[model samples]
Target: MSQGGTSIPDEEWERFLREAEAGSAGAPQEPSARARMVTRRLREQPGPPEGWRTYRPARRRRGKGWYVLGLAAAVALLVVALVPGLLVGWFGGGDGADAPRAAGETQRPDGPPAQEAAGRLPTPDRPFSGSPAAGWADGTAGIHLPAARATGWMSRSEVEQALDRTRDFLAASSLDRAVLRGERPSGAMALIDPHQSDVHEFIEKAFRAPDRENDPLLLFSRFRPSDVRPAGDVVRTRGRISFREGERDAVEVSTDVTYVYPVVRAEAGSEEVVRTVVRREVVLSWNDPAKDRVEPGTFSLVSYKVDATNGGCDNTYTGYFTPVFGAERAATGAGDGAVVDPYDRSTPIGERMREAGDAGGGTATRS
Candidate 1:
């Protein structure tokens, strides 16, 4: 090839080829004077023809500000990745973390929020005076039985006797219309075991009504002992008397009394009486006197609970009577107008009864 657009004559090219052939033929062929002259002439390579200039790559140096910005961006990305995990570990509960928490500081997965949990309130020990189920309307009207004073340690027989006396009094007085009519039975108050504040209050509330003239039949209608028939006698089921060193002696007597009564209901303007068998569970507690010698008449009633009712009788209306006029005689009419359904707790009679003046003995209209 012609070098860089320089032309080579045919004679010179031929001479060069002859020299190259001579060199390859195993002859010691050093360059001859003519070949040297010809090579020197070919070595003069031509440059670019008119105005082309050589190009040089430019060098760029970055400033400190660019390096600083790159470094800051890297640091910011690292912080963004790690900050949430650090926050969770610091303030909120972290995985496998066992940190101490303040008292009452609870965390429930499905319960109320943290503020509500921290500010939760406590429940009352005793919301009302009587049974918890009775709510504010517990018939006792906020009255609680007084604690009974104990006599000395009473024998089981003595406890049974006291309970028997209590049962007999309850059975006899519970049915007497005279007792139901706001008239205390003779000596009935004595049988009440004066220490029983609950019994005393219960008796007091049972026999009186808000208005004697207008609601004359209210007290009687609510409680007519005429319906009660003792199955046999008060039967003692459980008796326990405890005497321990360094402790006050206590007697607990439980008895089951069965009463048969007719639960009367007015149906279709007529009267339907259904006899019910009610099992009353009477539990009594007596404490021994703190002194060495037993005090006479110191035995007192502590607690009494009526158990489940097995039979059905609306005998609640035995006291509720209508006035009947006759030519020669006057008789009490049927209890059709009596609102003595013991199960009818919604009746306004209980409120009215509480409004009645404090009576010595009264029965609950809605047992």
Candidate 2:
């Protein structure tokens, strides 16, 4: 019939009413979506993706015709007596706030509450459910490599090798289950320049009998085997790796990455969970070992620092992280200093590093 100068075909009108009544919706993807960058990137960006408008067809849009059709549909609807179910579906007349919730959903906000209130419980299945790390890439996938370019002193291949070695070092030190569970970080240690005997010896000594002065946790993320264990196999990570030419024809590679470890009490049937954020900043130097006895692909550890937040302030010099949970934090404060956000990656690693339970490991706090 002709209404609002736009004809509403009998078949199209009927189909529209039926679809509205049924409340049609497409099926949701299964297994849930993986988070790309758990940080600000996850938020809705300001505009459409690059070249979005350029690729669109240049066809003219049918503007007010859609509005006229809507008006005609409304007139037709007013004339026809509507059923209760159709009315309810058409205008959302169901329970406003009294509807039963889904099996696992709650009425609270998206993420965990601020530290002022009681800590939130992370779902057992998705340990990162209420955490920012939920959107972050899983494991080493988060550590992406930039296009390898030759520096003044280093060849393209050399720079590429440096990036790989640095990435491997990060994966071995932070994400390895054996190392996290208090085993030796031999893989990570092996990546160090073998010719740097002092550095190698220091790591060996730290592992054998770490004290307040010689702690290995500065470079490796570890948890006390008897105290805490990972909630799942995944460890969310995000960061950047870059390289530049330093003095004396040495290629300097710098890595700044944050690792989020979801851990739970080691006790059987413990449901409580806590996350420990470790931000490590490592500087490695590679020089032409034409005459020296350094390993071909090895890097000399120029310097390394770490910031371990959301952990116990009273870490025993036992060479393992003592993360704080809700119960424990209630009895003993998470820390005395300012509250630290475990997910903040904006700040540099040096500014974040603190002397939290310094194991005689000299003041990591930089001026």
Q: Which candidate number maximizes TM-score?
A: 2
Model 2 per-residue lDDT tens digits across residues 1-367: 6778999999987786565445455322111000011111112322111110000010000000000000000001111122322211111122111111112111212433223223434644556655556555556555656778887456787677667667777877777766777778777776666666555665777789876435677677788868987675577666677778764566777777767777788898988766666667677776655433456556666665555554434325567667666655555422233334545556553343332222111211100
Per-model TM-score, in order, reads 0.30, 0.62
Q: After superposition, how far is residue 97 of candidate 1 from its true place, in Å?
A: 80
lDDT scores of the candidates, listed in order: 0.26, 0.51
Clashing pairs in 2: 212-359, 212-360
For model 2, give the 10-residue run with minimal summed lDDT: 65-74
* Cα misplacement distance, residue 144 of candidate 1 (Å): 30
Which lDDT tens digits does candidate 1 get at residues 1-367?
3889999998977877665444445422221000000001111322101110000010000000000000000001111112222211111111110111112211111321122223222112211111112111111111112223333365445544444444334433333334433355543355434544443453454334322112212111123334332211111111112222122554544333222222333223323222221222333444445432332333343322221111212222122221111221112222222222222223122232233223211221211
92 Cα displacement, candidate 2 (Å): 44
